[model samples]
Target: MKKTLFDKVWDAHVVNSIENGPQILYIDKHLIHEVTSPQAFQELEERNIPVLRPNQIIATADHNTPTQDQHLPVKDLLSRNQLQKLSENCEKNGITLYELGHKYNGIVHVIAPELGFTQPGITIVCGDSHTSTHGAFGSIAFGIGTSQVAQVFASQCLLLTKPKSLRVTVNGTLKKGVLPKDVILYIISKIGTNAGTGYFCEYAGTVFENMSMEGRMTVCNMSIEMGARGGMIAPDETTFEYIKGKEFAPKGTEFDKKVAYWKTLPSDEDATFDKEYFFDADQIEPMITYGTNPGMGIKISETIPTLDDASFEKSLNYMGFKAGESLLAKPINYVFIGSCTNSRIEDFRIAADFIKGKQKAENVTAWLVPGSKQVEAQIVDEGLQTIFEAAGFELRQPGCSACLAMNDDKIPQNEYCVSTSNRNFEGRQGQGARTILASPLIAAATAIEGKIPDITKYYLN
Candidate 1:
C-alpha cells in the first residue's frame, strides 16, 4: 500500500492498536525539559514509578535558565528551583541531563538535532510544543502535555489517534530577502491557523527540496502554530548529510544501513493525502505578524488588513495598530534575534553578516542570543562574535532568552519588540508587551533602523 512520509514513520511506531481507542505508539526518543517535567516527575513519584528507559530519555534545562551569568548561580527564586529540581529528577531517575552551563545545554529542540538525537523513521516527543521541530528530519515528532510526559516516562509509549495527512507544496524560487520563516508565516496567513487541524503536514515541492536542513527545521518548528499535529519533510541527501556525523547519530556501517532505510521513507508516488495545498514561493516576501496570532501576518511591503470582524478589530486594538497602516518605519523599542525557532548558527550567521559594517540604532536595545552552547562556540570559532561585537550587539549566553517571559529576559510592558521568535500573542514575551514577529533578517534590519524598514531597501542599496 502507498503511504505518505508521515504514515511511513507513524505506522512504524505503532506498537498496538486498541479496538476503539488511541493506538499505543512507542516513542523512540523522549525529551524532557525543566518547565513541564517537574509536575510530571512529581506525578511519577506519587505513583512510585521509575522511568522505563533512562537511556532513551534526554533532559535539558533551557526554558527558565538565564541568558547571562552562566558561571554564577541563578538569582531568580523560581527559575533556580526549577533547574535544581530538574537536575535532581534526572539524577534520581538515571536519565542524562544537560544542565545549565553544560556544554550541550540548549533549548530542547535545538540541542536534540545538534546532537543528532533526531533521526528519520523514529518517534519523538517533548513536553514543549516546538517538539515538532524534529519532524524536519522525517521523524514523527510532536508535543505532549504533562500527563503525557508522565505516561512516556512510565512506559516509553503514548496513546495517540492517527492524524490525517495534509500535503503543502511550495514550488518556484523565493525572492531575495525572503526566508523559510517568511514562507511559513505566508502559509499560515493564507490558510488560517486552523487549516491543518487533525492533520500531520507533509511539506513538499522545489522550495523545501532545495532548503538546507536548518531551513527545513525552521519551517517545521512553526507547524503547531497552524494547528497541525506536526509537520515533516521527506529525508533526502541534505538530511543524510546533516546527520552523517554527530554525537548520537549512527556511525560507520550502521550509518550506511540507516541511510538505506531512510531513503525509502518519502511518500510513495501513488500515496494520497486527505487534503492538499499548493503555493508559489515567488509570491512570498519577508513576512511580519501585525496582530496577535501567527496567521495575522502580511508581507513587509503590505498594509494591515481592514477587515470588519470583531476579532480582527480586537487584534488591531491590542497591537495599537490601525487598519491600512503600514508597519514600515514603526518605532520599535527592542529587537530579539534568538529562540528555538531562529537561534541556530545559520540564523546567527545571517544576522551577523548583515550587521557587520553597520551599527545597531542607538534607540533600539537588541539581544543576540545563541540557541545552544555548541552554537555559541561555533560563533566564536567562525568569528561571527567579533562581527556582532563590532556592530554594537552583545552576544548573550545560550538559552530560550526573550522567546518566552520565563526568565529574567523579557520585554518591558507596553514596549514594541521586533522579534525573530515565533508567536505574537499578547504577553507571550511579557505582560503588556507587544511583539512583531519577523524573520531574523527582518529583526536584524529593524535593529539597525530602530524600527521596521523595507528590508528590500537594505538589500538593494
Candidate 2:
C-alpha cells in the first residue's frame, strides 16, 4: 500500500487503536519548557505520578529567562518564579534540564533540532505551540496541552486521531531576497490561514527539494499558523547531512542504517492524499505583514490590502493599517530578528551578509538574538557577531526573545516593529506594539532602510 510521510511515521508510532477515534501514539522525544511545563508538573504531582521516561524528557528555560546576563535576577517576579519552579520541578522528577547559562539551553524547538534529538520517523511533542518546528526533520511532532503533557510524561504515549494528509508542492526557483518565510506567507495568503485545518501537511516539489534544511525548518515551523496539525519534509541527503555528527544522532554503521530507513519515509509515487495545493515559488518576494495576522501580508514593494476583500478588517484596523497604503518608508521604531523561526546560524549569516559594510538606521532600535547557545557560539566562531556589532546591531543571548515579549527584548508601547518571529497578533511583541513579521533577510534590509523596502539590491549582487 502506498503511504505519505505522515502515514509512515504515524503508523510506526501507533501502539494501539482506540474505538474508532484517537490512536495511542508512542512518543519518542518529549521537550518541556518553563511556560507550559510548570502546570503539567504540578498536575502530575497532584495526581502522584512519576515521569515514566525521564531520560526521554528534556527541559529548558527560555520563555521566562532574561536574555541579558544569566546571573542577573529577572525583574519581573512572576517570570523569575516560573524559571525557579521549572528548575525545581526538573530536579525533583530527575529529568535532564538544560537550564539558563547551559551550553545547550535555548528555545525548546531550537535546542532539539540542533542537538539531533529531532529525527525522521519519530514522534515528538512539546507543551508549546511551536512544537511543529520539530516536524521539519521528518518527525511527527505536535504541540499538546498541559493535560496531554502529563499524559505523555506518565505513559510516553497519547491517543490521537490520525490527521488526513494535505500535500503542498511549490515549484520553480526562489527569486533573489525571497526566503522560506516569504514562501510560507504567500501560501497562507493564497489559501487563507485555515486551509490546512485538521490535516498533516506534506511539503514536497522543487522548492522544498532545493531548500536547505534550515529553510525547510522555517517552512514547517509555521505550519500551525495555517491550521495544520503539523508539517513535514521527507528526509533526503540534505536532511541526513544536517543530522550527521550532531550531539544525539546515530553514528557509524547505525547512521548508515538509519539513513536507509529515512530514505523510505517520503510518500510513494502512487500515494494518495486527502488534498493537495500547488504554488509558484518565483512568484513570491520578500513578504511583510501589515495587519495583525501572518496571512495579512504583502510583498515589500506592494501596498497593504483594502478592507473590501479582506475578512479581518477589524483586526487589521486595530493594528493601525489601512487598505492599499504603501508600507514602504513608514517610520519603524523597532526591528528584531531573533526567534525560533529565523535565529539559526545560516539565518544570521544572511542578515549579516546584507549589513556587513553598512550601518543600521540611526533612528531604528534593533535587536539581533541567536536562537540557541549553539547558534550563538557559531556566530562568534564565524565572526558574524563582529560585523553585526560594527554595524550597530546588539548581539543578545539565545532564547525566544522578542518573539513573544516574555523576555527582556520587547518593543515599546504603540511602536511599530519589523520582526522575524511568527505571530503578529495584537500586542504579540509587547503591549500595544504593532508587529510586522518578515524574513530575516527582509528584517535586516529594513533595518538599514528603517522601513519596509525592496531588499533585492542588497542581495542581487
Candidate 3:
C-alpha cells in the first residue's frame, strides 16, 4: 500500500481496532518528569494498581530543580515538595530514577536521545509537549495527559485515533545564518500554527536530510506548536551514527539488525500523504518571536509588527512592544542559551565559536547551560567550557532550568530576555518577563551586542 511513515508505524503498533474510533496502540517507552508524574502516581495508589512495566518507565527531576546549585536543598517550598513527592513515588513504584546531580539527569527529551533510550520504529510517550523530539529518530512519540499517563503505565498501551500524514518539504540549500529553528518558524508563519491539525508531519527534503541530528530534533520538537499530532524524520545514517555507542543502543550484531530495520522505516517512493507543503530554505532568515505566541515571529532585521498588521494587540501590549518599533536595537537585560530546544552540544559549540575570543556585553546577564550532564561533560572535555568561561558566561547545572519558571533561574519582571527556550508566550521565563526566542547563534550575537542584531553578520563569519 502507498503509506506515509506515520501510517506504517501506526499500523504496526495497533493491537486492534475499536469499532470506528481510536485504536489500542502498544507503547514501548514511558518517560516521566517531576511536574506530571506525581499526580499519575497518586492515581495509581488510589486505584491500588502497580506499574505494569517499571523497567520501561524512567523518571527524572528537571522542571523544579534549581539550576545554580544541585547539591543544596531547593529554597522554594512548593518546588521542593514537588520534587520530594516524585522521588517518594518513584521509590515506592520501583521505577528507575535519574535524580538531580546524577550523570543521566537532564531534560527528559534531552536525556532520552543521548542515552539512546529513544529508538526508531517504537511508540514512545512522555507527559511533555516536547516529547515530539523523539520523532527525529523515525519513531512515533507523543505527549499524554495525567490520566493518559496512568493509562500507559497500567497497560503499556494507549487509545489513539491515528493522525493523517502530511509531508512538508524544504528543497533548497539554507542560506548563511538560517538555522533549523529559523526554518521551522518560517514554515509556521507561512502555514499558520493550526494548519497541521489532525496530522503527523513528515519533514522530508534535501535540507532536512542534510541537517545534523540536533537540527532535526529542533524542528521535530516544535511540531506540536504547529497543531500537528507529531512530527518525524526518517532514520538515516546520521541518526544511527549518533546513537551507536550510547548506553542504551543495541550493541554488536544487534545494532546491525536494528539499523537494517530502521532503514526500511522510511516511506516508500510511492507513498501518499493526506496533505503536502513546500518551503524554500534560502528564503528563511534568522528568526525572533516579537509578540506573545511563537508564531508571532519575524526576521531579526524586520520591525515590530503594528496593531493593524499584528494578529493580536492585547498580547503585544502585554509584552511591552510597540508597533513599527525596530527590535534590533532594543536593549536586552538577559541572554540565555540552554533549553531542550537549543541546549545540545552543537548549539553550545556554535555559541562558543562566536564568543570564543571576545567578551559578553557588560550590561547583559549571560548563562550557558548544557541540556544534559553528558553534554556538560562533552563541553568540558572539548574545552568549550573554558572558552565560554573566559568570555564571562556562567555555566550552570543541567535541568529544565529557566526554560520554565519552576526553577530558580528567572528573568525579573519587565525585563527583556533573549532565550533559546521554545515558548515565548508572555511570562514563559518568569512572571511578567518578556521573552524573545531565537537560535543559539542568534542568542550569542544578541549577548555580544546586548540586544537583537543582524546575526547574519557574525553567524556567517
Top TM-score prediction, candidate number: 1
What digit string (tens of lDDT, one per residue) describes model 1 on residues 146-183? 99999999999998999999999999998888889999
Local accuracy of candidate 2 as per-residue lDDT tens digits, 1-461: 99899999999988999787788999999999888888888888998999999999888988867888877777889888998899899999999899888999988888898999889999999988778888888899899999999999899999888998999999998887788999998888778789889999989999999998889989999998899998999889999999999999999999999999999898899999999999887788888888888878888878876566545677766777777788888888789998888989889999999899999999889899898889999999999999999999889998898999987677888899999898998989889989999998888887888877656665542
> Candidate 2 at 428: error in angstroms?
0.4
Clashing pairs in 3: none
For all candidates in order, the CA lDDT equals: 0.93, 0.88, 0.88
Q: Residue 108 of model 2: what lDDT?
A: 88
Q: Each prediction's Cα RMSD?
A: 1.0, 1.4, 1.4
TM-score of each: 0.99, 0.97, 0.97
TM-score of 3: 0.97
Q: Pick the candidate with the highest lDDT.
A: 1
CA lDDT, candidate 2, residue 356: 93
Full candidate order by TM-score, most accurate first: 1, 2, 3
> What tens-digit string does per-residue lDDT give for candidate 3 at 1-461?
77778877889999989898999999999999988888888888899998999999888888878888789888889889988898898888899899888999999999999999999989899999889989999999988999999998888989888888899999988877788888888788778788889999999999999999999999999888788878999999999999999989999999999999988899999998989998887778899988777888888888876656435877788888787777877889799898888899999988988888988889999988889889999999999999988988889989877788777789999998898888887778899989888888888888888878877665543
Q: Using lDDT, rank the candidates from best to worst.
A: 1, 2, 3
